[model samples]
Target: MSAFLMENKKLLLDGSVIACVEQRDGEWEDTFICMGENMWLWNRTFTVTDARESWDDFPMEFILQGEVAFYMIPGVNYNGNFWGEGKEPKGLLDDGIPWRFAGHRSGVRAGMLAQTKEAAVGIFAAQENPMGCSMEMERAEKKGFCMRLHFPEQEGPRVYCARDSYEAGKYMETTCFCKKNLVFSAWIVVREPQKQHDYAAFLDKAWEVCREEGSVRLLTDEQVWELGMDFAKNRLYFEEDGFAGFCMGLTWKDKGWEQKRDYLEIGWVGQNASLAVSLLYEYAIFGEKEALRRGLSVLDVWCGRAALPNGLFRCRFDQIRKWGGRIDNDEERNDAANLYSAVTELLEAYHLLAELGIERKLYRKTALAICSFVTQHQLESGKMAKAWFNDGRISDAEGTVGCYLAEALCFGWKECKSREFLNAARAGFSYYYKEFEKYGYTTAGALDTCCVDKESAIPLLRCALELFEITGEREYLEAAKQVSSYLASWQYHYNVQYGGHTLLGQMGYRTRGGTSVSVQHHHIDCYGLEFYEAWKKLAKYTGKEIWRERAEALWENALQNISDGTLVIKGQKRPRGSQDEGILQTRWHTKRGEYFGVSEWLVAWNTAFRLKILRKDFLARKREKSKEEKRIS
Candidate 1:
């Protein structure tokens, strides 16, 4: 063990030694370094006193100042820059804002990982702090970049009523804090490079560092599956004079559950057809006739009416007006991600119906038409346009947004046995993988935000794994492992502290395994559900237990805040089996204050994502039980 003492507390890193030294009047810092066989642990604690009488937040900022070649604060700043056009980020959570680059521990993994020429260093904080913490990375001129961890994290370009539409704005002033006495502690790990990139080395230690925090699972898989099915069939499912499908979902306000947005959206948040697939699962597993009828009815409506003339599918239906809706304009254009989702769900629906000896040629036909359009228009570089109108005109052409289509193409290839679909899928994955290698991250995955994000990495991982399975290629398997590190960065490794008054806190919500949405959207969601299967497969293929653990952890996180008929928030009751779309894990402005809570948008995807997973697990367990019973008999 080694200790250092100095006046100006700055962390020092040379090729041989990693240490920090700092001490001043009214401030005391203790630093220790313990060497291990493969990894070294560095511990730091700061004690400080404030003379000010009162303040809203008191912060203790710790710096792992060093000269490093690469640095990233996951889901936030990657290599101290933003991707895309040079324009400033538009929303309250601006991705391009200079210096004000701190993200709440809950919004990310609450750590900074950097790589020097020889080794990888990760600095992570414990999440039990009442005021929360934030991780920031900034370039320090000739000295390289500095990774700063903030306790009671406060930075400027502070936001108020962020993205609220009614009262949204930001300021350049720094968030001030004054507390009489404060103590902050964090753990640091230094390890040798183990993979082609340093991300894995740091992520490995990060998981180990936070393993003690553990996770809490509120409901069993069986209970969750049953509640979710009921919610989908009874509450979220919709029927009208001519149309039968699922509405987007209910929203909460001071009033009780309100079903104001009466629309059947095909993909993204609406997940009408996607949830119907879940209904099919319930029917297949539990033999519920209504589930089968409702599921097929919803799919039938979409398959019959959604195909557009220009070979694209209309993804949204305004139920109130009984008309098809186009995204972003009056034309027939649709966002790439939503369009990909619509195609994928249609393909899945086709598979289920076929298995039941039910002919759904319309479903198969519509999906193939849309996918054929994609393969025909695929760029020479394997890039697909972000959005396209029914007239075959491109709306937006830049960014990795087209990567969303990669998974859909892969599935389409399997169904049709078309080399065109397979080739496009391979090309798209290759292009996006190269882009990620060049930029150190993925971008524009989320439709609302056009900046670096974690969601885009999902398709990359899925495509890589799927390709590896189909072709038996080791290169694709390696790509999946690399992408897993990037995906892991977006997940919360520890349980974040929530204020007692907040809904999340009141319910004892654990942030662990909840994935942050993106850099521009500073919130957590069940997006992890999209890629847990890939993680589980990576574990099986690579024989790495860490990937398996992560997959399980992510499953539990997605189940948080699921309403079991009696779930209530803000003195209002939520429908059973419903779950909010976004959880405000940090001090970000939203409908639910600038603290920990939920956005009250009980999106259909949240329930659908869980139902899909639970249905799979439940059936597997039943199969195992059946085998055991047969053995005894």
Candidate 2:
């Protein structure tokens, strides 16, 4: 034990040692060790050898500063023979680990037990021993025994008391005291590392490190070409050809019951519908019939005219449905809005299908049904309120809803060339423009309020830009510029750590004062990278190089700070007034350096859009550069 103490002096110097001992037949045995530091105790165990052959000594050492003393008590043995003789002595034996009764007035009592020697530690907090000393020992005998020591004050004499006993094995409990408060970090020593990464190939040959270590399931004709597979066999197709239903995203490999439940719950149909529309457009350009067919089927599902009679559109079935298949009123309205966007996407799919010369009456009927529903729901003001909410009224206005409406209206205008559809799109754009003008690019309402910054600002900016592109309206372009300018002003210029390059621009009076500068609310819901990308695109389209430069810098900073492929956004700073409260602050770190899922939906969409835009722009630049090079030559 002394040698072990000498060996682990560094760890011991940082904390006090707590020892638990058991005595049977006048022989003492050490059970566990706990190290106390700060205000928390960490549990550890060590092996000790008896100094005397007689085995009567219990020797433990703890370094102490200022006045300190030790207290002890003899173990009360509860042998089965003594129980028959009398209850008092047997009662003492029945309680497994001893207890300390001294600081009762201060309202402090604690218990410790070792479930097994192999386990690291055991701890229990109590105002008083619940089972009394005797019953505690009986319980310990059934399982294992435990011991607890209490040191109320380090400034005075230290006292230890034995209260009860239980079944015995190796376990430890620790306590620490400091002037302010105790900080705790658990040190766990497992037999094997919890996580492992492969680096052997990189070590051997750095160039070979780029090789992927996972399986690839190509779901596109282009992917087939890339993989050198037969085009016919590799062509992407829906699971049910000619049947309309949403495509599933990534599937879990484990196929566990919980994963299955989650799969059914959200459905993620809206995003899938968007993916399908994009894929269909790609298929038309690439002349891939299988991809085109699959995309058309998905569009049919989005339009709510699926092969299944009662199948809803891309409405996120589970979110809308409550118990007994009753739909939540608010969710139903949101679902309706989602379906509206899906229907608009279906219009695009129809155009692609027509271009591909795939004639199916299903597409026409689906399109007509969608138009009828949309027309029926239009208000006198040329905009439609969300449906299926309380009293079937749409009162609360949100940015995303307006964005979806604008998108749907644009689709309608292009498809039918209707004046009413154009007006509807204009009205949706008006809502966002007016709101942004009034709020000055800051999020309106309280921090706790729904449809906060991410929900409102980004969508509003997106719709404004789209409106400008479709209508060629200078007013819409100016409005988009205003919103973009406001968004850029709140880019969190000084601290890259706080809020991750974007601030929660809107705040209520109550929360504004208390809001932590560096802390990000999980509910803010905006994608920093997406905002940057959107601004960058707008800058390119408008020939505004400054906007492009600013957005590029923000994007680079965000990527540098908060991204790894598995997107975790930790709070970069402690909350206001938390410095003295003794809490650990948050940090941004991820396993994948270049990619992070900070906002999965936004990031994915933004990345796809940026890649498309950049590819086209790159080719144009390359052509211009080649022409110049030829002239020079």
In order, candidate lDDTs are 0.69, 0.34
**Could you tell me every candidate's TM-score relative to the true structure?**
0.84, 0.43
- Candidate 2, residues 269-318: lDDT per residue as tens digits? 22445545655554644456775666565555444422122223325433
lDDT of 2 at 405: 57
State the weakest 10-residue window (summed lDDT) of model 1: 164-173
| Top candidate, metric TM-score | 1
- After superposing candidate 1, which stretches have Cα over 4 Å from the reference? 1-29, 35-69, 84-103, 106-110, 116-119, 126-135, 141-144, 150-153, 157-161, 164-184, 191-197, 260-263, 319-330, 592-594, 616-633
Record all residue pairs in model 1 with backbone atoms less than 3 Å apart, i.e. clashing. Answer: 565-576
Q: Candidate 1 local accuracy as lDDT?
A: 0.69
TM-score attained by model 2 = 0.43
How many collisions per candidate? 1, 30
